[model samples]
Target: MIAAISENDIKKLKEDLKQKGYKLTPQRRAIVDTIIAGKGSHLTAEEIYDEVKKLCPEIGLATVYRTIILLEEIGLIYKLELNDGCSRYELANKDEVHRHHHLVCNKCGSVIEVQDDLLENLETEIEKKYNFKIKDHSVKFFGLCSECRKDG
Candidate 1:
C-alpha cells in the first residue's frame, strides 16, 4: 500500500507542531514519518524506537516515549492499550471512516479492525430502547482466529 503519510498530511503536522512550539528536530520528524510509513499497521513504542534507531542510533528510548505522548496529547494519533501490556499506536486520519472497534484473537493476540456501521446502529437502538444515552464505547471480540483454529 502507498505510504499513509501524505505530503499534505505531513505539511499540516509540521504547521501544527510549529504553532505549538514543539521543536521539529530531525529525530522527532523522522520518528513521525517512520510511524506514518507503516500505514494501517499498529506499532508499539518499542517497535517505533527500534526503527528510529536504524536511522539515528544515538536517539534514546525515552525520547520516543516523550514524543509519542506529546503527539497523542495533540490528537495526532490514537494510542491503543492492548491487554498484552503493550500499547500500539496509529495515525489518526480524520477524513477516513473511524476504525474504532477491534476483533481480537484470544489465542494469538491478533487484532483486526472492525469497521461495521451495523454494530453502531445496533448500539444506538439498544440505547434508545433502554431510554439511555450511549457515550463512547470500545468492543473486543475474543476467539481463536482462523490460523489458531486450524492449529488446534
Candidate 2:
C-alpha cells in the first residue's frame, strides 16, 4: 500500500517515451504516479483518472485513456481484461520474465494475484512436443476465496 515511484523509474519511463517521440508531461507523470502507487490494485482507466485528477485538476478523461494506451504500448504497463465490461491495468515490472496469474473469487468478485509461475514443466513439455517456443502465458482461476468460503 505504501508504494513509492522512484525517480529512477520516472527517468526510465521518460527515456522510453523519448524513444517513442513523446515527453513525460506533468499530466502524464501524474497518471503514471497514480498507476505506480496502485500497481497491485489493477485499476481501470476511470479509477486512474479519478486518482490523477486529485493531483491534476485540469486533467481530462480522454488524456488518461490516451496515456494508458501509450504506456501499454511502451511496455510500461500491462492490460488485464477480466471478461467484465472494463479493462484494468497494472504496472509492468522490469524484471518480470513472465507475468503472474490471478485467482478470482466468484462469490465475492475479489482478485488475488498468484506470484508463482507454476507452469514451467507444462510449458517445457508442450514446447518440446509441439516444437514451438513459448513467449508468455496468462492463467486465471475462478473460485471462492478463503473469506468467501468461510462466509458460505
Candidate 3:
C-alpha cells in the first residue's frame, strides 16, 4: 500500500494551493480526504465523488471532476491512464523523482503496483545516447495476474 497521508502533508498541500492562488474549499477538502483514505486504490472521479458525497452530501460530481483537474494541474496528483477506459489518480510522492510503474491485469482489471524502478539503466542509456535531460518517466505493463493465469 502507498504511504498514508499525514496531517503535515495536508497542511503543506494547503499552503501549496494558497501559493498557487487556490484555496482548499470544503468540497475540495472532502475529495482530498477521500483520496488520502483511498491510497493505492487509484480512484476515479466517480468513485471519489461517491465517497465525498458521504461526507458532503450536497457535493456534486462536477465539483469532484473540477477538483481532480485542479489537483492534477498543480502536480499534487498523477492521473494514470490504462486500457480500462477510466482515468485513475494517485497522490504524487514528492520524495520520488520518478513515478512508480504499474502492472495491470488484463483479465481481472486489477492493478498491481510495481514499486521498483526497473528503468534506471535504460533511462541512463537513453540519456547518454540522446543527451537528454531525463527527469521522470511512467511505465505500465499489462498481462494476466497469477489468479487469472491459474483460472485460464
* lDDT (CA) per prediction: 0.79, 0.89, 0.88
- Per-candidate clashes, comma-separated: 0, 0, 0
Candidate 2 lDDT over residue span 1-152, tens digit each: 32677889878899999999999999998888898889789899999999999999999999999999999999999898876668999888778778889998887778899888899999999999999999888888988999999997
Best by TM-score: 2
TM-score of every prediction relative to native: 0.81, 0.93, 0.92
Ranking by lDDT: 2, 3, 1
Backbone steric clashes in candidate 1, count: 0
User: Which 10 successive residues of model 1 have the least lDDT summed?
Assistant: 1-10
TM-score of candidate 2 relative to the true fold: 0.93
Runs of candidate 1 exceeding 4 Å displacement: 1-4, 122-137
Candidate 3: clashing residue pairs, number = 0
**Candidate 3 error regions (>4 Å):** 1-5
**What's the lDDT of the predicted structure labeled candidate 3?**
0.88
